[model samples]
Target: MLDIKFIMENSEIVKAACKNKNEQDNVDKIIDLNRMRKIYTAERDELRRQLNEISAEIGEIAKKGGDISSIKVKAKEISEQVKSVEEELSIVEKELDRLVLTVPNIPDSSVPVGFSEDDNKTIRIIGEPQKFDFVPKNHIQLNEKLHLFELERAAKITGSFFPLFTGKGAKLVRSLVNFMLDIHTADGKYYEIFPPFLVNRDSMLGTAQLPKLEEDMYRVEQEDYFLIPTGEVPMTNLYRGEKLSEDDLPIYYCGYSACFRREAGSYGKDTKGLMRLHQFDKVELVKIVHPDNSYDELEGLLHDAEKILDLLGIHYRVRVLCTGDLTFASAKTYDIEIWAPGTEKWLEVSSVSNLTDFQARRMNTRFRSSKDNKLHYVHTLNGSGVAIPRLIISLLETYQNSDGAIEIPEILQDYFGAEKIE
Candidate 1:
């Protein structure tokens, strides 16, 4: 949440940011509401002071054996006035709180000014898309010959976009999860967390996903719990409503979870193979760090995620998301897109983001600074160490031989208990 004080002091700047984000939140309405709140507060305070004075006067009159009825009448009038102002103030404050939550995070100065993914700037291509001696088959064609996955069975069991893997396909999923988890927990120095897949409404709101993207979530209506869309949602909220000391300036956590999404508006895009799915696996990375080092940590997070692709020897590129492409709570984001040889396209596998206190404010997660002994919101960051299905798609398509066997990357061969899948 953008601080109300900051918005109040700089309404125009806030409005411009809203414009840039193509959001329609009314800055003027918020400002007017705040002004009304201030007026009502002042009126209430003045009336309270008058009520106290009337009490004092009445007490003095009673002690001196003077008529106190007039003072009592005045006290009654003042008390009623104060109650009226309190009621108005409460209404205005509630409205103000509601509007504030609608405001999007202000974009960082470094973010490119643009309106869509097409405008995003490419950072660099890490590895070249391999040239094939024979025609490269897409994941669907390759999977048909290999019999590694069954989409028809999955569809019959759980509707479309649900994946059911068999043989090495199932083992591939397990191996990837373990391999990614090990990288982040071991060399990345991140503590691993196996968080609950279900979360409450407040937990969803804390991650800035509730009010905005309700339709995209799966909710257990009876229990009011939401199946998490990403491990970031639950992992980031671990320190919610808590305060950490300065000694713990930087805290890192990596979580692996089965994510569920409704994908409500997506009708006909990437429906053929593993492009988009209703349920998927992901290894998520989250960091809570001091404001001074958040961007640095963001870079570190990008490199950490990139290492997985490097070890797996997947060809990929990095893209800096333009302002319009940034997620609801991210101040800045970098997406890592891996090349899929069969599809001849780049599939986004991870999005490393620096939320820059936007989420911390919502979660009420703070840290006390030793230098000033003042409490400040810690910067929050999260990324997919990598999402699974697309990576699986890339792996099958990229490493498949002319004979239809998949040569497992050297890093994962031991985990798969074989060098190749035939």
Candidate 2:
């Protein structure tokens, strides 16, 4: 949510952002509604003042043995007018709030002006994509040969886009989770949090996933809960509606959770394998930092996530998302795409974004600045400290041998309890 004062003061910039982001918001309508609400607010305040004056007059007249009925009637009329104005004010405020929610955060000045992913600029490539001696097989073929997962049975049980990992596959997923969490929590930089997989409507809204992307969520209608689309949702909401001290200005959290999404519009894209799944495991990294230092924290967050790919020896590239490709709440974003040899494509495994108080305002999470002791919204950032499925695909495809065995990354050897999967 943006400060209405900021919107009114910089309407043009806000409108330009709406255009760049490809979001439709009636800036004029929002301004008009706010004007109406302000008018009603003044009228209500004036009515209250008149009523107070009338009450004082009525008391004075009664004490002085003068007839107060006329004054009482005047007060009653003022009271009725106040009630009417209050009702009008309520309606206008509600409408203004709805419109305000539609306004997206302004993209950072550094963000490229573009309308699609094609416009995004690649920052750098990490390691080179593996050159396989064999005609490397895709994850689907590798899984089939290794008896890793049962997608067919998963489809029967859950209707598709679900995987039932068998034996070593299950262990690999668990090992990845532990390994990632261990690194993020190392040196106590990130506190590992165990969050609920189900979140309420407010939690979704706080993370800017509701009102726009609600259709892509699985809702438990009876409980009015939405299955989390990412660990970011719960991790960021941990301090919702709370204020922290300056000492806690930069809080880093990493959470491992199962994420669910409907993939509503992606009907025929990446339907096979773990590329598009209804449920997937993700290790998420979230940071809450003082606004002045938030951008710096974002780079640190990105490095933390990139460390995972580098350590895993996966070939990946980082791209700074163009304005139109940026997430709804993110002011700026960097997408990390890992190369999958068999798929011959770069799969985005994580997005590090600097929301920059966009989410903090929505969540009402703030911190008191030591400099002034004034409360200010904290800047929130989140990245996938890499999502599991695609990373697994990249790993298997990149590490697969001609003999149909998969060599495990050295870092994960201890967790996997083996050097390779045959």
Candidate 3:
């Protein structure tokens, strides 16, 4: 959540920031609500002072044992007025909070002004697209012919966008998860955490996934917990409400978890395969760092994710996310897209974002300065160190051979215990 003081002091700047991000916010109404809440508070305090004075006078009349009824009645009327003012104050406060939540995080100055993914500029291309002589098959066809997947049973059990992996498909999924984790944890010391599948509402808000993406999530109504949409949700909340010392400036965490999303609004897109799913496996990298170092951490995190596609020998590209394409918590974001030759498109495999104090403020997660002992909000960041299923899709499509074999990348050959998956 944004600080009200910041909003009050920088209303115009905030409105301009929202305009650049192509997001709509009722800035005028937000300011008006703040004004109303402040006015209500002042009046309520004044009324309470009057009520206290009247009660004191009533007490004196009672002590004197003469004509206390009039004083008592006056005190009672003041109490009712105070109650009415208090109720109005409560309404104004709620409206102010709702308005504040509607205002999104401002884009960093470096963020380019754009309204859609089409306008995103490529920062650089990591590796060349794979050269293939034969016609490459998509993951769906390859998985089916090789007896690697069973969607029929998956549909019966759940519904569309769910696939059951068997034989090679299961191994492929496991291998992908293991491979991604190993790379992210190599020397970087990303503490691996296997988080719970379900988390409370506060967990969702910490990562800026709630309030807006609430509809896309699966909530257990009675328990008031929601199935995690991604490892990002639980991983970031690990340090929720925590205060770290300066020496703990950076906390790197990598979590493996099963993510569930309703795909609630997406009706017909990527329904045939793992491009989008109700449930998928992922490894996410989350960091809590000093504000000055967060942008650099963003690059490091992106490279950590890019290293996977590079190691897999899969062709991919990295794009600096335009402001409009950024997540609610991110000040700046970079998405890693892998080339899926069969589909003739780039599949986004990960998004590395730098959220400077936006999440920390909401979570009340802070860090104390080593030099001055001053507490400050830490900048938070997270990325799919890589998601399993989509990367699998890219790998299968890029490595497919004319003989219906899929050559495993050299780095993962030993992990999967064979050079080729056929």
Candidate 4:
């Protein structure tokens, strides 16, 4: 949440951010509501002050053995005025709160100003797409021979875009999850969290997924719970409504969860095989850090995500998302797209973002500084230490042999308990 004070002071910046992010501009309305809120609050305060003075006068008259009924009536009138003003203040504040959540985070100056993903700036490309002597087959084509997954059956069981892995395919998914968790948690770099797949409304709002992306989320009917769209929702809200010590400036957590997205607004997009799915698995990385070092931490977060692809021997490139392409909660983001030769397209496998205290404000997560003994909002960052589906796609397609076999990367061999899937 952008601070209302900051928004009031820097309205233009917030307006530009809303425009850049393709969010509705509610800044003017919020400001108007805030002004009314101030007026109502001041009126209430003044009424209360008058009531207090009238009560004091009534007490003095009563002590002096004089008529106190007039003073009492005046006090009662002022008290009623206070209540009326309080009700007005409550209405204005509620509307202001609602509108505030609609505002998008201000994009960092470094972010490229563009209207689409095509304008995203590529930071670097690592490795090269594997060259095959034979015509490469996509995951679905390779699956027919390897018997990895059953998409039609998954659709029969659930609806379309749900994945059902069988035999080696299931093992591949498990192996990738374990491989990612191990890498991230190794050397105690990130604390592992096994959070619930279902979360309450506040948890969604705390992660800035509510009030905007609710349509793209799966909610439990007749309840306030919603299936998590990503582990970031549960993991990032770990410190919700809490304060930490400055000594714990940087806290790392990694968790694996089944992410569900309704994809309500995603139409005319590729939903073939694992290109997009209603359900997918991911190992999420979250960081709570001091505001001063958030951008640096963002770079480190990107590196940590990149390291997974490096270990897997996959060719991927990192693209810094432009202002218009950034998510509602992210000030800046870097997407890592792995090369899938079979599909002849680059598939985005991970997005590392620096929320820059935007989520911290919404979560009410703060840290007490040892130097000044004051609390300040901590910067929050989250990344797909990598999502599983597309990674599996790249692995299946890139490592395919002439005989329709998959050669697992050396790092993941032990986890898979086999070197190749035939």
Which lDDT tens digits does candidate 4 get at residues 124-207?
999999999999999889999988889999999999999999998899899899999999999999999999999999999999
lDDT of 3 by residue, 113-198 (tens): 78899878798887777778888888888876787777788889998777688887898888888888888788967988899999
Candidate 1 lDDT tens digits, 318-363: 9999888887788899999999999988999999999999999999
Q: What are the runs in model 3 whose C-alpha is more than 4 Å off?
A: 46-81
* Candidate 1 residue pairs in backbone clash: none
Tell me how far the alpha carbon of residue 398 in candidate 3 is from the true structure, in angstroms, after superposition.
1.6
RMSD of 4: 1.9
lDDT computed for candidate 4: 0.94
Error of 1 at 283 (Å): 0.1
Count clashing residue pairs per candidate: 0, 0, 0, 0
Model 3 is weakest, by summed lDDT over 10 consecutive residues, at 17-26
The TM-score obtained by model 3 is: 0.91
**Order of candidates by lDDT, top first?**
4, 2, 1, 3
Taken over the whole model, the C-alpha lDDT of each candidate is: 0.92, 0.92, 0.85, 0.94
> Candidate 1: global Cα-lDDT?
0.92
- What local lDDT score does residue 346 receive in model 1, on the 0 to 100 scale? 92
TM-score of 1: 0.94
